[model samples]
Target: MVEIDESHTSLPVLAFFRSPQAGRSWVTAAGLVLDTANLLFSALDVPRSRQVELTFTAGCLAVNRVQRFFDKKAETQPTELRTPEEVAAANPGREAFAKVWQELRDGGLPVRPDEEAAWQHYQALRMRYAPSIEFLSQLLLAPAMGSLH
Candidate 1:
């Protein structure tokens, strides 16, 4: 067994990489949806650029689904806010957001279709209304195989 050093700055990231059952259920569910989206879209005779667009769109949907699940969970369970402020108060600086993102990704909750659609629209607005911030967030949370695995 790889003894994961919990003290590492990337501990939250490692938490996400651990067994799929341990953390949030949303992450795994979103991953499944993304995989399905990829498979479904790959068969279409779309242009490469279109395919990439579709993939990014699907990913946006999947992430929104995850967010909805967490939102609902927060409503029912009423856990502490995992926002940057709260996380920063505990861990400080980038480490806080990193940890929160890891927690959100590892939670593995299920997102509904409606929620996914809403998220897509929200993402579009963000892209249009606040391109720089949206782009920065994307840069911060660049998807990687390890995040899903």
Candidate 2:
């Protein structure tokens, strides 16, 4: 599991895939999160902020690359939505993250530790934004659509 350091404000984001198959899974999961967030934000009348756009684009690119990999594997299936619990359960290539962190701790890695810390920050931000996302999704899909104003 990728462990977040509580003392740090940033969360470390790591992508690990020894095989192309695992890579696809990571990409798909990330893409789903970003896409869902985007739709929910837009529905809630949230402006297209630069951070949101960048996140959305990164998700889409990941999805696209994963799709290409799936094509190579001759697999076909629609994207699936996964909950945070499911994501954690998958144990998706987190060891790579640990290795990178270890290297940084040993002063062998060139990347600044702060850059890795950003992942923790992102996670915190995600939690804060989740309520907004849910509210927007519900507001957009309400049956009467009369109380949104």
Query: On a 0 to 100 scale, what is the lDDT of residue 60 in model 2?
Result: 45
lDDT of 1 at 83: 52
Residues 1-149, candidate 1, lDDT per residue (tens digit)? 01222221223333234343444332333343443343233322234366655554655553553333333533322233245542333212334323433444456532222433433443343342122212222222323212211
Each model's lDDT: 0.34, 0.36
Model 2 agreement with the true structure over 1-149: per-residue lDDT tens digits: 01111211122123222224422333334434653454334222335578767665555444444334333443433333545544343232234334534554465434334534533433444444333223322222211111111
Using lDDT as the measure, which candidate wins? 2
lDDT of 1 at 47: 40
**Candidate 2 residue runs with Cα over 4 Å from true position:** 1-28, 73-149
Candidate 2 Cα RMSD after full superposition onto the native fold (Å): 18.3
TM-score (C-alpha) between model 2 and the true structure: 0.30
